[model samples]
Target: MQIIVVSRHLKSARTITIMPRHVLGALAVFFVLVFLSSAFFSFISLHFRLPIVENILLSVQQQETRQTRDYITNNLNLMATRLGELQGRLLQLDTLGDRVSDLAGIKPKAADVAEKPGQGGPFLPAPLSATELQQEIERLATAVDRQADDLAFMEFKLLEKRVEERLMPTTLPVKNAVFGSGFGYRNDPFAGLRSRHDGLDFAAPTGTPVVAAADGVVLTASYHQEFGNMIDVDHGDGLVSRYAHLSAMDVVESQIVRRGDKIGAVGTTGRSTGPHLHFEVRMLGVPQNPATFLKRGEDFARLQRR
Candidate 1:
């Protein structure tokens, strides 16, 4: 584009040439000037705290503050709900600990007293602040840890009790057998003289199944001149059990056996008057009353049935 300037003072007309690039450069410079002016005015208004500017700034700050407050309140509410759930779970663990303590025959700790019933008087509501809510959550967490420890101890005690019961000679040797002679002094059937009978007798038919009274390793499975086809089991802790006068032996020496495992069959072998099983319990080589252990076994079985 071209533009002619008319001037009477000039000897000739002056001609100016305009291009698209010049128009574009002018537009860019105009935009820069406008932006600088606007920034300068904004700085002055803020520094002087103009009424309109101050009101607008205050409104924006208030909105941000409200959003932050709402966020915090929601978080606190969530924490409080979680704290209540943890308390309920702790109560359940306490009840389970009590039941397990009974089964394990362990006395409850002094701190494990029963919880008091709920109390009520007024319905006044007081909201918890952030600090109070945090403290409560921490306290509840500590209580949960304590309850977990108590439960763990109770579980260990229960397991120990079960192990002891398994090792003791408490199961009946011959099932459905009639009780014959008792332990202690009695008349010898063959000699007809008073003699100390070291074991209890169970009368059953020949070939009736005879089982182990406890878990143990077989120490001897051989014939004794007096007991005849006898089996001795070592039940650890210096306790041993003997099952004598068997028609057949099913286990061998050094074999492991669990309670109620079949070890032999009933038979009246050497020095016996009839088909019967001679059961004896010995601790450290001294004879013990087998009846006591058998009675305990019966009680344990009854509890299991329940």
Candidate 2:
């Protein structure tokens, strides 16, 4: 390619030669630079201004954050509810265990069974942080585990105690009976001399039912000259209860009987007394104090004194 230049001030016309490849190369370079500059500026503007794309991205991120928070909150609430239920069950177990211990005459070791968890005063408390809540939950879980162990041990002990109590003489032999002759030294009406009374005499009407003191098997249910119609129950561990001076016997030898079951009816057939029941609690053939085994209820205590 050839280029011609005319200079009117110089009054001269000149002709210069140019290469086609060189001109094309220069045009290609210019276009390349323009494309690069345009791309750089477009990237800068997109980064600074972002438009609706930025809002869309932010919305997606916010949704994800909200979902994460809700998931955490829901799980925390579930855990809290479960923990509350466990605590309630633990409290119930404690109450039942205490009652059983009372019946067994066993004292409780820990006094904190009635105490509640840690509590804040009237001041408003701040919400626990994540770490704090987790720590507290773990602590509560450990406490629940410990309580479970204790309750299991207590339940086992209570069951053993129940078995033992059933085989021991511990209740009244006659219902609504007044005290007649007490245990120990007293004047014998028949002999007219000071004699020893080995059992308590409960005066009742004729044919008043006499119940067994504890769950046991009848050892002797026969008539004797000194006892009239009588029944003796052999509780386990060398313990026995005697219901003597009866008008009629309801149990036979070797018959199983529970506490409060009718064994006979009261009578004065034995030695001359009013219609009465001669109740005796014996261990190894030796008489024991009936007051020592009777319950400590208010009415029973009054009856015991009477």
Candidate 3:
């Protein structure tokens, strides 16, 4: 294309020719330069690890990495703390187990039976290369085993003592009566002279029912001159009890009787008395204080409830 230009200030006129190839080539080169510059900067940023630039960029990356590491460490620490708590719980369980075993009368060796879970299977042994925490848990388990044995023994002894006490004649042989005469020597009611009284006398109306004071088997249920209509019960554990001066007998020889069971009636059959039941409690053929065995109100009441 041709173009004419006129400059009025200089009064000049000129003809100019325009070329499109050079203009197009220049515009393309300019665009290429912009693209190359951007690509170059990006490459330097990625590959050429320049210390100052890299450090600034790495600061943010390092902060993120540090936060991640700290979070992992905190989690690990929390886990360790929880594991320690579990170990402590295991120790407590061991101690409790020992106490229970002791009360059960089971031998330490026999504890193997209970050592395993009740659901199924034999005992599980800890591995040789166990962790320190696991070893501590095992130690606690062993301690519990020993304590269990002790508890079992204690329980057995307590039960035995309770049985023995129950078998003792430690309450009123017959209900609702006062001690007319206590054990030991007092003026004989018949002769008015000092004589040893082997038993105690409870003053009650004649024909009142008498009951056995403890569990025993009747050894004698026949009449005697001094004892009148008498019943002698032999309580085990080397003890014997005698009920004398009775109106009638309710049990026979070789018959077993429990505490509070009817044995006979009270009467003035043998010696001179208005009417009374002669009750005797003896240990190994020697007379003991019947008053000690004669529990009064509420104390014996508690026993009967049991």
Candidate 4:
């Protein structure tokens, strides 16, 4: 290369010398240094076989794959556990379903219609498919609903039973202080010993108020041959009670009466007994143990204690 120099201030001229060889030598050294550095760096990079950017990308990809696998594994395990727990709860619900059905008087098959189970093994089989699981869940929900309804019905029944029990007599028909005759076959006080007595007798002072043994309606209230005056009260549920040997009647026929209501006065008008009341309990016109109905209250109390 050749170069020319010029200066604007020319008061004194100065000459500068230039050498092509020195310039070429310097350029050669520069080329050699660049080649050596490139080779060294190339050797180091190829020997290790990865650049900083590539290594960073590779590490990031590895972490992502590992995290993805872990996430998938954990989620699958959690889903399996949840499905297992749901299956167990569903089993319990099925058992509860049967119990509730029984309580509600719902037969497995009624009116010639029966339920058909899905295609599956026994209830204790392996985990079900998604469709089968969905069906099971639906069945479980239905079972829960049925159980709830059954529980409500049972509560209502219990309340009804309580009301009925409360309305029952469960007390001694005649006063405890005075009872003329006990239950069982006995000679009629009015008739001879050959006659059989249907019910017990209550001996009391004349005009003593005779109360109803239980809540009922007066069925019959008129005179009779063997018994001078009698009142037949028909309680609900096929229960009928009789009050005989009354001096005067206070309630009329077909009149409603409550338990322990004054229905008549005890007297010896029928056969040949002193002032007394003859009481009898009958079910559908059949004679029953009067003492049983009279002790219901006490029996209930004992049961509650138990």
Candidate 5:
């Protein structure tokens, strides 16, 4: 580039040439001035508390603060909903525990009664803060744990009851047999005089199946002179059952037997005059009324039916 200057007092014209370097230098100086001016104005604005700049900065900060508050509120709301669901599940566990306790016939302990309080009211909606919600969730979780423990205890008790029932003499020895003389003082069929009958009699056809009344180990299966072919089963807890005048013996001594297992057949092998079963129950080697145990069995069966 070129520039010419005309002068009349000196009677000469001056010509100036512009190169690429000169153009570059001018651009650099212009940028430097612009940068310094920007810096100066920014410093002045901050030092003098300019309303326009301050307002812009304050607006940006307020927007960020609002966004943060909204995020926290949304998270807390979701957490509250989850806590409510957990509480509902805890209530269901409590109800289940109650049912199991009833089925197992478990009486509530003092601790259980104290833990559960009667609580009922009209629904009142209220918003909870984060801290309160957390505390409530913790309390509900503890309740759920307690309910689980209670249910486990009930289950154990139920199992124990079932085992005891199985071990007890609950089944009738002879099915569909005619009842003869019962346990008590009665006229002796052989002596023709009043005597105490230590057992009950069930008259049945010869070779009629005679089953065990309970679960036990056969202690004796041998022929006796007066009782004829007899079998004694030793149930646990010092209880024993005797079956007299058996026609055929199906079980052996020291053999385990379950309730209703066929142990022999009915017959009149002893001092009796007709085919019948002499069933006796004894505790600690002492005679007991067989009717009492049979009645208990009947009551248990009736309850099961109900």
Candidate 6:
């Protein structure tokens, strides 16, 4: 590049030649200075509220902040509602547990464990704070956990005791059957003399099903001289039930059986005049009145239903 310089001081003219590289360098420097100056002015204008674009950006940022806060509040409220529902259910279970314990005649000593599992206070027409709700949720959760464990344990113990009680010879061996002969002394049909009858007799038709009185193990199931097609079930704690004069025996020796299990069929297979079932309950080989045990069992069942 070349530039012509005119100097009128001495009435002379001079010509200067510039290299392409130097000219390009000078142009580059000028462009860089212009860019820096433009950037500085832009920043100053935005910082001093000199542009409408800046105001719009600030408003968008504020709106986003409010929306975030609202979102957080909504989420907290939802969580609180779910927690309240759980707490309500827990309360019902607690009440049911207490009721069952009273019915079973068992009381828990650790009722006031950790915290009381109940709700009470003044009713206010206002929303709860997030912090307060969170704390309440924690407290309720703790109480429910403790009570649940306690109730589970209590239920197990009661269930075990109930099962033990049921596994006794306390129910009728024949279902809905009437007694044909009473216990104690009776005139023997074969001997024609007063003899002691050790058991009650139910006059049922041949093949009338006879069930077990309670849960027990079949100790003996065989025929005898006086009792035909007999079955003896050994209940726990030295209690036993005998069903005699059956046409057929369904259970074998040593087999475990539950209450109401079909153990035999009714028939007069022994030295009797008619088809009947002889039922006897004994404790440690000592005979007991069958009516006493049956009555007690019936009463207990009625109480449970209520």
Assess the local accuracy of residue 278 in candidate 2 as a C-alpha lDDT between 0 and 100. Answer: 87
RMSD of 1: 6.5
Task: Write candidate 1's Cα lDDT for 88-120 as tens digits.
Answer: 988898788778878878888565576878998
- What C-alpha lDDT does candidate 4 achieve relative to the native structure? 0.72
lDDT of 4 by residue, 1-306 (tens): 445556778655556666888888989999999999999977777688867846876899999999999996776666566666766766676577567656655565473246666786567757565566556656766755665665666657667776676456665554543655667777655555755566667677888888887777899999988778999988778888888888999999999988778888888877745777888888888888776776665432232110
Prediction RMSDs, each to the true structure: 6.5, 14.0, 17.2, 15.7, 9.8, 9.1
Residue runs of model 1 more than 4 Å from their true location after superposition: 1-42, 114-121, 299-306
lDDT of 6 at 115: 77
The model with the greater lDDT, 1 or 3, is 1
Clashes of each: 0, 0, 15, 1, 0, 0
Instruction: Provide the overall lDDT of each model, using Cα atoms, as 2-decimal numbers.
Output: 0.90, 0.81, 0.76, 0.72, 0.88, 0.82
Which portions of model 2 show Cα errors greater than 4 Å? 1-141, 157-170, 270-274, 295-306
TM-score for candidate 1, residues paired by index: 0.77
Name the better of 2 and 4 by TM-score.
2
Better of 3 and 6 by lDDT: 6
User: Candidate 3: which stretches are off by over 4 Å?
Assistant: 1-129, 296-306
The TM-score of candidate 3 is 0.56
Error of 2 at 246 (Å): 1.4
* Highest TM-score scorer: 1
C-alpha positional error of residue 99 in candidate 3 after TM-score superposition, expressed in Å: 11
Candidates sorted on lDDT, descending: 1, 5, 6, 2, 3, 4
Candidate 5: where is the Cα deviation over 4 Å? 1-82, 107-124, 298-306
lDDT by residue (170-286, candidate 3, tens digit) is 757666665577778999877899999888787778878898887889989998998888998887887888999999999999999998899998888876566888888788888
